[model samples]
Target: MPTWRPLTPNDITGLMQVANEIHPGLPERPEVFINRIALFPAGCLALEDEDGRLCGYAISHPIRRRCPPALDSVLVEISADADHYYVHDVAILPGLRGRGLAAECVARLLASDAAQGYSVAGLVSVYGTEAFWGRLGFRSVVVDEDLASKLREYGEDAVYLERVLDSQ
Candidate 1:
């Protein structure tokens, strides 16, 4: 069975390789991953397959409500006014998609210390993945002008989705 572990700087190379294969059109720089890992290590994770190979990764952090960072952009710092947990990115290798790894990773992330206190978790669902995210409890919300512009950076089909994280 595949499992998720804390991502370290050393995992970036392997993580990027899988990211490229999985998201060729929507590429993010290594610095972005580095920034996220540096900003909130607890929210950074690497997925290791049965043979202990890096197969995927998840990047998340707290952010101001409705202000998901643009794809491939660097953050100077986590928002000081952060009121939400933003699921920045979660990618699984193609072959591993249907095995429930993405859902498992999401559940783990939502329960992490970094995710605590956030009333909701939000993500910019790219690659026509709104339905997939919806199955995980996210629902698309109408955006205003400022946010609508930000979503443009993700691509035409990008949809902003969020799920209430009922406190435990």
Candidate 2:
């Protein structure tokens, strides 16, 4: 059975391995993974096998944006006003997909953020993941020129999606 756990320094390597194996175009460096994990320790979660090998991972950051930030092909930039939790990235090992690991990883991250007092989640979807994010409660938000200009460095193709958490 797969189990979820808070990602630690020890799990960083495994998580990077799985993420790179699943998503080809994403950054797969251990340094980048470590940086994100450090940015949102509580928001990063990992799914591991029975023997403790990582099978999936999710990374999110707390964004203080009131309006959803603009997305333009993965170049997300936050303004001083927007407030929400933004999912940086989520991935599951290709060999271990179809087992709900990706969804579980995301759920775990959201649950952690909620427990930490955050009430919203957001992310930029690309490579045909808009529908997948929609199924997970994310809605499409229009990207404006101001935000688009900031994200122009990442090219002009990434899509933005947001999910508001209910204050239950």
Candidate 3:
């Protein structure tokens, strides 16, 4: 079993390894991960096995509705009045699949955001993984022309999804 904890600067290398394994061809520069942690430490998390080896990571933060930051780009700052808690990225290594670590990490982040009074959660699904996020209660939504154009940077198959969170 693996335990989930807040991500620290020390976990960057392991985080990149998992990111490469799960998100091939996606932009996952170290500075992006570092900045995410700097901006929202609580929303950035790592999963570690009993031996204390990191196997996965999740990065999330508050963002304005219908607006997701561009891939591989760093946010100057997170919006304090943002209406949606956005799941920017989550990845688990191939060997660790089917063990529910992904779900556990996402659940923890969503619950934490809900407790912080965010009524909605959103993610941009790529790599034909919309069904995976759908299983976690997200529903696909048609974005306007402008937002759809922004999502294209993630890849041709990128889909936007959102879910209303139950008040904590």
Estimate the TM-score of every prediction: 0.96, 0.77, 0.94
Write candidate 2's Cα lDDT for 1-168 as tens digits.
787777777887787678667665555467666765665577677888888788877777667643433321222333345467888777776677677777877776776633355567777776678888898899877677764564453345566777878672
Question: What TM-score should be assigned to candidate 2?
Answer: 0.77
Order of the predicted models by lDDT, top scorer first: 1, 3, 2
Candidate 3: tens digits of C-alpha lDDT, residues 58-117? 899989987888888888998776988899988887788888888888888988843377
Q: Judge candidate 1 at residue 135 and give its lDDT.
A: 95
Q: How does candidate 2 score on lDDT?
A: 0.67
TM-score of 3: 0.94
Q: For candidate 1, what is the TM-score?
A: 0.96
For lDDT, the strongest prediction is: 1
Clashing pairs in 2: 64-82, 64-83, 65-82, 65-83, 66-82, 66-83, 73-158
Worst 10 residues of 2 by lDDT: 66-75
lDDT of 1 by residue, 2-119 (tens): 8999999999999999989988888899999999999899999999988889999999999998988888889999988999999989999998889999999999999888788999
**Which regions of candidate 3 fall more than 4 Å away from where they truly are?**
113-115
What C-alpha lDDT values do all the predictions have? Answer: 0.92, 0.67, 0.87
* Two-way TM-score contest, 2 vs 3, winner: 3
Better of 2 and 3 by lDDT: 3
Q: How far is 13's C-alpha from truth in model 3 (Å)?
A: 1.0
